[model samples]
Target chain A: MENVIKIRGLTKNYGKNRGVIDVNLDVAKGDVFGFLGPNGAGKSTTIRSMLGFLRFDEGSISILGMDSVRDHEKILRDVGYMPSEAWFYDTMRVSEVIKYAADVRGLDCAQEAAKLCERLKVDTHKKIKELSLGNRKKVSIVCAMQHRPKLFIFDEPTSGLDPLMQRNFFNLIDEYVRDGATCVLSTHVLSEVNRYCRHAAIMRDGRLMMLEDTNIDEDAFLKYYMDEEEM
Target chain B: MRAVFVREIRLNMKQLIIWSLTVGILGLVCILMYDSMQGDMKSMADMFSQMGAFSDAFGMSTLSIATVEGFFATEVGTVHGLGGAMFAAILAIGIISKEEDGHTGEFLLSLPISRRRVVAAKGGCVLVCLAAFSCVCALFYALGFVMLGEDIPFSKLAVFMAMQLLMNIEISAICFFISGVSPKINIGAGLGVALICYVYDLVGRVVPDMKDYLFMGPYSYANASEIFSGADIAVAGVAVGLVITVVAYVSTFVCFDRRDLAS
Candidate 1:
């Protein structure tokens, strides 16, 4: 299978601190790839570099066979991205926020957005500021999924979601994957990787410690977390 | 681009209305009060025109405050000029930086649009809002003239307003550049720019040596008293303002495109 994302020698830094050092990664098309890391482990930094949001010190990132920096606009057309925290225009209604997202992509996503909202149980009439964290996450999910892009990049997607909503979100992801879409799910949750990911990469201290198939036992995954805690 | 433009306009609508109305109403009230203060102003104009440096700074030596035209020029002119500059500065200064400050830049920049396009769309929003503000305030001034049954000084008013628009655009362009380079919204710095420019113009008028270099500031060409007194427009000042506006506007696009946006 062809790779949808490719990174080589990726390095980013903030002064003396490490961001990501000499990192290399690839996510093949149609694969559910889990990027697991603890807070401050540089998962978000690597993801942002891939999305052309940050200027890395040294690296090359290609997404959907296009340069992340040079062809950013083209790559975004077929990529759906959801940040860890969903911050929107607070005064706008949920429906309006969704519409704005769709409008920027120049897509008619009303039907898809409505279906997503129904499944997620989002109140379209309420202002964004009026929604709970879970509800706001639901809105972010709807906005990301409505356009039905070929790839989805979700960072800590289930943090604010309740158990039920988390199940719904995974179900939605499963549906997209079944339709031949690729996904890069960045999260610290091991169970989510065990349940959904086919391939997973463990990151620690701005380094990729291991990349393996999810067939590994839960105890093996827990060892990586435990080792970090001990250190 | 249109999507971002429309969204910015919608987001900024409330601010536009509030700033425009506050300045507009203040100008209208001052225009209305001219009738009640006519007698007192007639005597005051003579005293004011003879106050040397103070008179020169406020343009009382060139335009008497006894007549409605002079009153509008000195009073309503100062109000609109200062208010418009501050509004333009405040609006443009926060526009780009506020995205990061509010944590909305992640959502916005993630869209399938380039940073250059985003900057262009926001620049369009600032221009449109400033134009609308000028029009609304101009209408209020016109209404006041109608109620008082005075001749509307159409030509002079047009020149004054056009110059004021250019001045505001110059101020806003500088602030827009500042917003692009800054990580957070700096309202204090924005207001400070406007205040400093106004003071520069006031001091330059009274201090003879500074008069020649007054074109360096935006307020020189937009001076109300000079326009109403039938003095020629300061072409050099206007040209310098336009040049600064273009340079700053272009710099914003260049700087923002290279920025590493905060998540």
Candidate 2:
């Protein structure tokens, strides 16, 4: 399968500190790529650079074979991104934010938005500030998934979601992949890696620890990592 | 850019509404206070002293509040100047900084827009908001005259409001510039801008000899109080204010585009 996202020697530096250093990875089309890392492991940094939010001192990023920065606008048209932090105008109700997002993308995803909101049990009429953490996550998910972008990027997508909603999210991704969309999920949730991802890249301290298919269960992988640390 | 602009507008409207209401209430209270003072006050000198104590920041030299021109200075300068400056500072502080503060920039940046476009669009929204507020204030001022049973010339009102409009853009630009440069601080940019303006006002008041060099002071407006008399407009000051706005806005964009966002 062709890669949805391709990176070669991607390096980003914030002054003397390392943001991401010599990182390389590829997420295949129609594949659920779980990009796992510890806190401050450069997963978000790498993802942001791929999305062109941060400038990299060295390397190349190709989104479906188009240069990430050069074709950023065109790529964004069909790329659904959910940032780790959920932000919306507090005065705006959930529906209004969704409408605003949809309007920006020129997508008539209202019915889809309604379905997602209902599925996640998010109150569409309530202010974003008034919503609970899980509900706010639902808001982000609904907006991200509603547009049906071909390439999906979710940064800590399940951070505020309850277990039930998280399961719903997995099912939603399954359906999306079945329809031939690509997804790159940046998260440390091990279960999510086992449950949804066909490909996984583990990162630690601004570098890739491993890139492997999930041939073994998550417990075995955890044991191996722990055993390696002890050694 | 338009898509981003539209969203910026949606966000700015809520802010504009809040600022408009607060500023409007303050103006109304001042008008009410002015109405109540007629019976108790002995002379315009007493009134100017009282008002000076209340709003020394707005006046260059105390004037008789009883006279319409002095009333305009007190009402427009001190009342609107301080309030308007504060209003502008707060508005500018958020325009460039709020998205990053709320972590919304991460989400928005991931979209197809460039950093430059984001900066320009966001800055443009601030200008739109300021313009909208100016229109509302002008409307209320006209309403104030009607309530007082005064028949002021529309042309004079236009000239006065025009100078205010120019001054406001300058204030907003400086505050917004502060926003882009200092994101970790909450409304620190606005407070800083207000302080700088207040200092300029002080220097203008304390040193009349240096008035040639310190045109930035709101006191400059005071020195040219006759400009609003429907006689002659000070086109030069307005031109200087425009230049400051442009430079401040451009600096803000440069700072925003180069900074690391995910951090």
Candidate 3:
């Protein structure tokens, strides 16, 4: 299978602070890849580098067979990215925010956006500031998924979601994946990985500690997480 | 680019309206009060003309304040010039940095648009807002002249407004460049820049030694008193201001393109 995302010798530094170091990763096409890490495991740094949001100190990123930096605009045309934090123009209504996203891509995503909004129980007429955290997350989800892009990159996507909404989010993901789309879900929630991911990579201290199949014995997985926490 | 441009204009519409009306109404009011203050201003102008540097700083030494044209140049000009500069600074200073400050950049940059295009679109919005601001203030001044049945100094007024627009563009460009380099919005710094430029021009006009270097400040070319008194427009100063504006805008694009944005 072709790789949807490929990273090699990826390294980034924030002056005196370490961002991510020698981080290499690959997610195959149509695979539900889980990037598991703790709060400060450099997961967001790596993801941002992949999306060309940050300039890595070394190595290169190729997404959808194009250079991340040189072809940044072209690559984003088919990628749906949900940031860890859902921040938007506070004065804009939820609906206007959604439309602005679609307009930037020059695509008509009204139907998909409407469906996602209804399923996620988002209030389209309310201003973004008026919405709760969960509602804002729902709006972000709708904005990301509405275009039906080929690759979906979600950074801690379920943070502010209620359990029921989380289930709905996964259900939406399942439907999209069924249509042959690939997903890279970066989250610390182990249960989410075990239940949804086919392959998982555990990262700690700005490096990848392990890459394994989710079907491994439950005991071994717990031990890996337990061992990291103890250290 | 069109989407970004449209959104920026919409986002700033409320600010544009507030600043334009504030400055425009103040200018109109000052103009309307000119007739009632004529007798007092005639005596004051005589005293002011002899007040040495203080009179020169405000152009009272060269332009009598007893007439409507002189009154508008000294009073309404100061109001609009200061107000317009502040508005331009505030508008452009946060246009780029606010994205990272507010965390909206993550969403905005994720779209299928390049960083250069985003900057260009934002620059376009600044130009539109400044143009609209200048037009509105001019209309208010015209209304005041009509209300008083005073003949408008069409030629001088045209030159003054044009120079003011260019001055605002230069101020906005500098603030825009600062916004590109900064990680957070700095309204205080933007206001500071405007005030400093105003003071430099004021001092340059009064001090003989600083007079030759007044072109370094944006307000030098946009001085309404000088324009109304039939003094030669500061062609060299206007040219230098345009050059600085271009350089600042180019620098902004270069800096913003390379910097690592905050998450």
What Cα-based lDDT does every candidate model obtain?
0.92, 0.74, 0.92
**lDDT by residue for model 1 over B1-263, one digit each (tens)?**
99999999999999999999999999999999999998799789999999998899999999999989899999998999999999999999999999999999989988899999999999999999999999999999999999899989899988988999999999999999999999899999999999999999999999999989999999999999999999999999999999999999999999999988987
Model 3 agreement with the true structure over B156-184: per-residue lDDT tens digits: 88899999999999999999999999989
Per-residue lDDT for A157-229 in model 1, tens only? Answer: 9998999999999999999989989999998788888889999887788987556577667677667666545
Cα RMSD (angstroms) for every candidate in the order listed: 1.4, 3.7, 1.5
Model 2 misses residue A103 by how many Å?
Answer: 1.1
TM-score, candidate 1, is: 0.97
How well does each candidate superpose onto the true structure, as a TM-score?
Answer: 0.97, 0.87, 0.97
Q: How would you encode candidate 2's per-residue C-alpha lDDT over B1-263 as one tens digit per residue?
A: 78788877886787788877667666655554555665554475464456542334334235455554556556555566666677778877877667777767766676667778877887788778878887787677667666766676477667666666667778888887887876553576576676677677666555656556556554354332354434345556666777888898888889887776744
CA deviation > 4 Å runs, candidate 3:
A215-229
Q: Considering only N, C-alpha and C atoms within 3 Å, which residue pairs clash in candidate 3?
A: none
True contacts kept of 3: 0.82
User: Which ten residues in a row are the worst by lDDT in model 3 chain B?
Assistant: B35-44
User: How close to the true structure is residue A190 of candidate 2, measured as C-alpha lDDT?
Assistant: 79
